[model samples]
Target: MKIIVSADIGNSETKMITRYDGVEGSECFHQPSVIRKLIKSPQIAETNLKKNVINLDENLIAHITSSALNRHSDGLYVIGKKAMQTDLNKVQNMNIKLGNKHKHDIPVIMILAMIARTVVKDEFELNGALESSYQIDCDFVSAIPASEFTFEKAKEFEKRLTKGDHTVVIHLGDKKVMVGINFKKAKITQEGIPAIFAMVYDNEENDDRKVSLLDKFNEVYDEEMEPNDLLKMKIFHVDIGDGTTEYIYTNGVNPVIDACDGERRGVGHATEDAVIMLNEMLQGSFKSSRQSFMEIIKDKTHNLHSEAFNALEAAKGTQANEILEDTFEKIQNKAGNSVDLITVYGGGSIQFREHLEESLRDYAETINSKLLWVPEELAVNLNVRGLDILNRTVFSKNKK
Candidate 1:
């Protein structure tokens, strides 16, 4: 069966969903947007394991191991969780860019390969197929930040991704499975705020017989509204990722591109502020590691069991509020009036939800905007979900 895959390659994580015969299948799969170069180990050479490593013509790769979660690797580099476990100094968070040019960076290639590997593995497992070399035809849909979403930029991304076939070998349990993927087509959508807007607005001009992502999101979120009415509602979409916070306005139907803007202030900024506050409170007693600090900051329920840590959380909360306040003010300045609905999504939405809500409360009366936080469980996958819907509806129709 031909499969369609939609991926949202965010700076913090990559979320993907797969579809078979135009029907969504399987739960979303996600991995950290991190990669690390492997330091050669003597044991590997002694075991003659070098031949097993899958070379991508790049310096790094997504490490596949015996774990069902694919979190281990014996390659020259590692991606995702395995990469995170490596020396913090060696692991680097990928910096995804929003521009009109293609980036041939190692992280980007690793992510693409990772997505393909994941789908191929799942398909094989479901079919109870033995481990062997197999070829699959796939159509891919992915997204970039909305601020740089243009025809030229989308074409550039598609060009990069479809230049040639890619092969990925993943070790699952004791079996080694090799997958050769031939991309039949690729669609690139604008992520961040615009993608969220697209998630809510169903375009009648596209295909009239299909349910859109907006329909799915509304159903999941328990929102009852007609598509026509939803299209008329003015919305301000706030997409807070690890590296950037994008602000976009939609007239319920189409994006108000001129009113869109982005800032580098996001969860990362708040985390840094929190770390600084904690260090000050502990008087240098609390040494912060990027990995540990990020975990604590992102997971709201993490118990650090220290007064300084609690105080640090509070400081981060306050900083998060400040960032949102600044963002709102900037949007108001450019748009003249606050929107009727303010929707928030992206990884940072869950991390900083309370602070964002608190900050919005301060301006609730003046802004007269209702907050709509994408359900916590679905926040990270919102963009890709929308892209998937677009692929099934618009792209599928175009292909026909």
Candidate 2:
């Protein structure tokens, strides 16, 4: 069976979806970009074991998980997280002097490889019917944000990924309001940045402050808030499981001012916004079996709103529709006249679609461009799709 592995490898999480012969299937996983490493007695690359010792190079054994986590015989490995979880302490002082950032790329490669291997193993077992003689298919499509994108980095990713059957790494970023597209082909195209967040911001103004639960705060803690102080306008960056949004400002002013919602400051605000949206939909009478807001994200929405269907239904009819329209308007205002297309994506894109379409429609009245609501399947994997297109152009010697 032919297999395709598509990944949107972002800072927070790396979401992966695999398909047999280019069709959707249930066999997939979303792994955090967290590697737990430990330097133990005898190094053994193990999956899901508590104390499996494995050799890192030779003398020092490193116990690694399919999650790319390694824990040492001592507690040093657990002291830090992410790329820092590795046993740099065990390495020579010279290597440590060169620093963690220098060691970052190699470890990232190892972590991704391990995760991919895990996906392969799970799929093979689940699809045991075909495991006997079926060819182990491996065509990968991975993506990185344009802000972190560079020619050399793309080449390096292409090299490491070559271990698979065939791979493509798409690079996506914003060029003004337009989405830039780069693919491996005779031709290269950089168009517009997908307006997923832009649409969200458009609806920001009219979203009953109640929806964000900030309305009570605005009233109770009544105070004239400055753009800088009361709201805490931070140039925070977020790399969702699918895409990255970096706050690029000049003299402390964001280019997409309207789109700025203070949520980019941290994962907490972003999570809170999602919760507030949920709570408001319940009309302040929501209850859930899932304990917290974070749980809502991991689980299904229907499950969370099962008890408040009527409130949710009403919320849909009123706030949801208006919010969507407002979102479209905001995206258009931000785009001005430069963009030819607005491609939308991310997990919330479907919920934001009506607004996106409305905004695109308003845009069509003046601009001669198309607003493509990349199909839901594509929405789930657009970053990978965009990255594949980028890899084609960046890696090709012909420079198409």
Candidate 3:
């Protein structure tokens, strides 16, 4: 069996799109980038779990199922939303400054877990018959932060992913099913440049929905860009991630790598700040990881809901200012002051959109440059969308 995929192993979430033959499997899927090793694996699912956690628009699905992943790792691990439930859930610390995240076990584990999630999820849709144990060949495209991306680094990451068969065991209360994964191909594009490809390709039949986003972009940004204008424009992009920010310049269809660079410190700083404040409020009686803190902010009925929201909101506001200021400075240094357009996107971009839009719109008007916070449709999943497009492009070529 073969699974083609496009993934972005982000610090906050592992976002991906799985393809069968040459088309996307409905749409994208994301796993919270939380992983935890279990000393004792819990009893297999007693409760009937629902498929596809929550439905986000545009065929996107989130994974929350708990499954054990052993992809060249030291021990059995739980990932996605399931890992967040563990007391010792491990998340990639966004505080690390360009420290090569893909070099570690986390990326490999997350990628394998993502593939497993897909496999377990549309089992009947798979081309071949399913068994208790079957091997899957995976061809995929994913990206790493520009701050840490290099040809050599990418090659190393590719080697890490394809080294051997990865095992993912799914416990279904009565029995367990194990699936083996083989890396047929993997491509790690730098984060800063892929969003443009998102504008270029989409697998869905009713892709005209994307036009609404472009319309929104034009109306708010005071620009008159038709469908084809973005790809033709001299574009500057600021991708604000959890732990880092990247600046990439694209003249027409080509990315100017020499003008693309990134630095540490992004929305992760706010997340850390909120976590510290929350822990302090609890008087150190309990511990909460970044993942938990986010959940706290989302849960309004939680005891510390108000406190968590306020703390996170305040921290996010401050960090947004700092990140945007730092971004402009870096843009001037690397990508220069003038460009036909400027756009920003990422998970960080979504969380900090209000602040970013207000400031960036004014900043753009000041320089007479059009600005887009990159419509919500293309926001957090921008890189993965682009990578998926690239994956299809490659897959089509191979088929030919």
Candidate 4:
């Protein structure tokens, strides 16, 4: 039977999907695109074969995905879930930073290969163990952001797969998601759409980090607000992440505005803080290396617990509100009647959902249309989902 596998690999997360015939299969396998290793026998380095896993120092690839860079004697290298156990001081590459620096599809290809290997290995092992008569192989269909999609790149990526080619698409949209179908296949037709930038730098001040349709609100909606004594309120939204924090602001119905002044906090620092606090608050799992904000808070952190914890207690939707409310209060004075409803989303949405909800409730009391707080899954994946929608629309139109 013919098989096609689609892989969506982003800096923050990796998703892999497999399909038989034309229908999407069950769950798509996924993993962080990181490998950790330690020096096993430095002197024994000689022959080399195809690169299977990243070799940091050549040990047994301890931990295998992430590891601490401690100069200590014991080589306990770790990667991914295992590497997250160490403090930021000890570990690096936890965020899996990838952008223009590396080849565009390098990270995704690595992740796809890993997924293919795992799936192929499992099928082979199980079939052999059960003494089955036949063997199975996999083909991969990798996807990239539609705005950034390219047929040449797709072809190059397919060539590297060696397993099989992948179908690539671009994901778009805000609350509603869409995808542009055959984005790689139709270069001329798809060129009209605006180019979307990867979230390399949250700040637009950087020359390379231009604003996108995602930041449409920031571009249009020309209005201003001065702090109003009546509401006596200020609001700020921060998209806290492993590498940086994104801040958006509003006084009262002036539309969400980007805050100019803020700190570039890393995910490791935020995670480290969360880990320390959770360590203090609870025992058992929290104390163990497996402890995550999702486990303790029973919500997603995407690695932004420290700020979310504070936001929750203050009844604010996002951590940015807590930190930058003062600035917003100043802008609230000249504002209109409508209280600004803050919508926060990202990998850290679940981390601050409870807090953001409380903040929205406060907005509802004074304003119309209640405050909005979209979760991380929807927030980050919104564009991809949007592209998918576009893809379907185009497909139907073409059929007609």
Candidate closest to the true structure, highest TM-score: 3
Count of clashing residue pairs in every prediction? 1, 38, 0, 47
- Per-residue lDDT of model 2, residues 1-400, tens digit only: 4444445544334455555544544234443343333443223235332121121111122122221122221121221122332443332111111222112442343334433344334443565311221224344445334334444555555554442232211111110011111212212111122223222232332233223212322453364432233122322111122122321211122224333321122232234344455667668664321113334444456566443333333333443354344434544554334443333445445534553456544654456643334445434434444333333324233443
Candidate order by lDDT, decreasing, is 3, 1, 4, 2
Cα lDDT of model 1 by residue, 1-400, tens digit: 4777777776666777776664545456676667665565212222222323332112124333211112234344566665665477677664433432134354344555565566545555567454466677778778666555676877877765566656665543334456666667887756664364345543542343333434544664478655466567787778888667777777865667778766665666655566677777768766644445776655667665455357556765765866677666866786677577777788788777776765664564477765566666556766776777777767766762
Which wins on lDDT, candidate 2 or candidate 4? 4
lDDT of 3 by residue, 1-400 (tens): 7878888877777788877774534557787776776656566434342322121111122222222223334556666676666564354333354458766666667777667656765673443333565568888778777888898988877776766556776544343557677777777778878788776453342264554446677677567666466777778888887777777888865888888787775667788888788778788765676767778778889988898888888889888878788767855776677677888888788788887887877777777777767667667877887777777765435641
Name the lDDT of candidate 2: 0.34
Q: Rank the candidates by TM-score, best first.
A: 3, 1, 4, 2
Error of 3 at 231 (Å): 2.0
Candidate 4: tens digits of C-alpha lDDT, residues 1-400 = 3344444454444444444435543334444434333354223342322222223212222211111111242232333443344453443343323322123433533343343343333343345321212223344333443223355654554444442333221111111111111112211111101011112112321233233322443323342322132133344444443333344344432223223222333233445455555555554234322123433344554454564465334332234355335324523542333334444444545554554456545654555533344334344543333233333334223431
TM-score of each: 0.74, 0.39, 0.86, 0.41
Error of 1 at 376 (Å): 2.4
TM-score of 3: 0.86
Question: Which 10 residues in a row give candidate 3 its minimum summed lDDT?
Answer: 53-62
